[model samples]
Target: MPELSGPRSGSEVPLELLRTPPPKERADAARNRAAVLEAAARLFAEHGVEAVSLDAVAAAAGVGKGTLFRRFGDKAGLAVALLDNRESVLQEAILYGPAPLGPDAAPTERLTAFTDAYLDFLLPHLALVRVSETASPGARYRIGAYRFWHRHVAILLASAPDPDVAAHTFLAALAAEHVAAVLPELGEQRLRAGLHQLGAALA
Candidate 1:
């Protein structure tokens, strides 16, 4: 018999419950997830993120409401899912790809490259990025991506007297709301220059 962790633990629960799903179920689940994502993307693209609902997504995907909710807990979850592919690609480049983004360059160069890459990514998906950031109070800082960025920045700032605080300040300057507010006045060129300058100062 398997050991139990608490009085409420179920020692009689079937072992199959703890095991991976059969291949067929796994394939079906994958297909359903893809279909839901595709449907949500198309709906959001045509109608805008604010205008579309999870119910609408479920109907569009031909999946049940329960399935949609189970797959993505809420609209914010859906937004994160939509951004995941692009985010993953950027993260991969940062961690493993060449030049200033990867291990091939100095820490300062990598930091500059990261800021440039992030700004480029943010500009194109301004609406989506904003939605993801503002999902709830302090939501942006709570996300996995935010943590990853913070850690990366902190590592690059290792020589700083207070790396954590400096990292937070650096990232705050690039917050979606802050950028959106200043972008029109500063223009992309000025904003990029300002970010590079900030990075240089931090370094």
Candidate 2:
């Protein structure tokens, strides 16, 4: 798999996949992926995610439709690629940053921090997140990112009455649609407060 480098931070994080060398790609193939991502981001920003299609993305990127299809299986795949960098950053923070989010923090504090950080990430990338989730009803739960988060939360909740249930329930509260649906009416402040309350209950 071709890997893209994400922004680095001072703290060292154990991201073995990211740290390891990826299989090399032909120069042209690399260029094409970059082109497609850039074009898709521009088009999505200007026309909105719902208005853009894979065909349009191919045209804008000046790549063949077949190339686009091979590069990204669908719009959801493209959205995942677009969000990869941001996701990596958050992952780094959780794994290696200071207290509250990193390993040094207490379980409750870590859980609270994760919820807040995840919500912060969700707001700006709501469109892409929604696209990924809507690709299939259970798609979000199956993604690699979701698995990582679930594991992290489960570990944090290890001492809880039921770690597995607590972790899943926590993640359910942060699902993209669940948050997006209430965002307009509740606003970020209220929404975050609600999530904090939920986290507190879990803790």
Candidate 3:
């Protein structure tokens, strides 16, 4: 139960577990968990989530299957960990990047920047993105990307003249339509155009 430190690095465990240890975890457990997450993310990004197995992740991580299961609980849990790792990076970008994204920009301007950044961020990671959508019931707790994007847009809307309606409308209008269908089928330009048009209309 390590707390995420700043915009740099740390673990994503429940806050309540911060002061409590299971009483059985060894010193190497932390290192092994980190390796498993790294390897799983790499394999899933390269071969798609369904294509990678628990055994493959363990092997790629240079750990045993028992260790992988013990660390993550199961394959789905491992996917959640991999996604959480990437989500942390995106969170860092939003919290610490330049103006319009990080802070100090107008609502409309921030909204525009967010759309552009989200499109760029989501384009290459379609594999993990799709897997995340299909992962769990309360996926946002693990995959914070969607919630982050929504909240960014919502914040921009709230800062504007009319917050309540605008924020809800903006989210609905901008959710990916045909672009997030899969890989290669949707180009960046097309997605960008859609986002721009939606942003303009909302503005």
Candidate 4:
């Protein structure tokens, strides 16, 4: 549950590790955005993400349906917006915080830390992430967040026979859809342990 308070002094980070903030909003627009996300969060929690609709979110937020669609595009986009803050925290940790989740750890340790930290965020947000990732064919791979994770894992697996392929394989197991499908059977402890073993083998 630990997170980076701020970037470490003198630490340089890759461009991919940087997340671009969304365009600034006007005061009224910002209020609308906040209301939309807040309403969506409540509805998703109350009824599950899959059961909620953009129309419902707009109604709950007191925004026009057209406004919601224009701002977020779709339910998947809304889900992505909702996770932005939590994802940024993890991103900052990987980009500049302390070992083993940050800069300076040995690859094996960093890899393990990454899985553990990722799961910490992911498990609680599984349904939201599953919607964002599985919204379309190859939607997960298309995400900038996925590219950042894949790059980190691929670099850590550089000594492996096929780092690129292995990284994809490694992340495949961690995908929200895949993890959600198996979690009920394997449970969190076994899943974490198995991922640790996989990380060791890949590293």
What's the TM-score of every candidate structure?
Answer: 0.83, 0.86, 0.69, 0.90
Cα deviation at 51, candidate 3, in Å, is 1.0
Model 1 alpha-carbon drift over 4 Å, by segment:
1-25
Q: What lDDT does model 2 reach? A: 0.78
Alpha-carbon runs more than 4 Å astray in model 3: 1-26, 73-76, 137-145, 159-178, 182-186
User: In model 4, what is the error at residue 82, expressed in angstroms?
Assistant: 0.6
Model 4: colliding residue pairs:
none
In candidate 2, stretches whose alpha carbon ends up further than 4 angstroms from where it belongs are: 1-24
Q: Per-residue lDDT tens digits of candidate 2, residues 1-203?
A: 11112222123232333332332689999999999999999999999999999999999999999999887899998998888778878877876787787667677888889888898898888999989877987999767677667667776766768766787898887888888888888889988888888877876
lDDT score at residue 180, model 3, on the 0-100 scale:
61
lDDT of 3 by residue, 19-106 (tens): 2122355679878988888898788878887799999999989999998887777665675566565556555556566777656666
List per-candidate RMSD values in Å. Answer: 10.0, 6.6, 7.4, 5.0
Candidate 4 lands at a TM-score of: 0.90
Q: How high is the lDDT of residue 111 in model 1? A: 87
lDDT of each: 0.77, 0.78, 0.60, 0.85
Clashing pairs in 3: none
Looking at model 2, the pairs that clash are none
Q: Which candidate number would show the highest TM-score if scored against the true structure?
A: 4
Candidate 4, residue 191: Cα displacement in angstroms equals 0.4
Name the runs in model 4 displaced over 4 angstroms.
1-18
Question: What TM-score would candidate 2 get against the native?
Answer: 0.86
lDDT of 4 by residue, 3-122 (tens): 223222122344343464665989999999999999999999999998998989999999999999999999999998998888888888887788989877788999999999999999
- Model 4 global lDDT (CA atoms, 0 to 1): 0.85
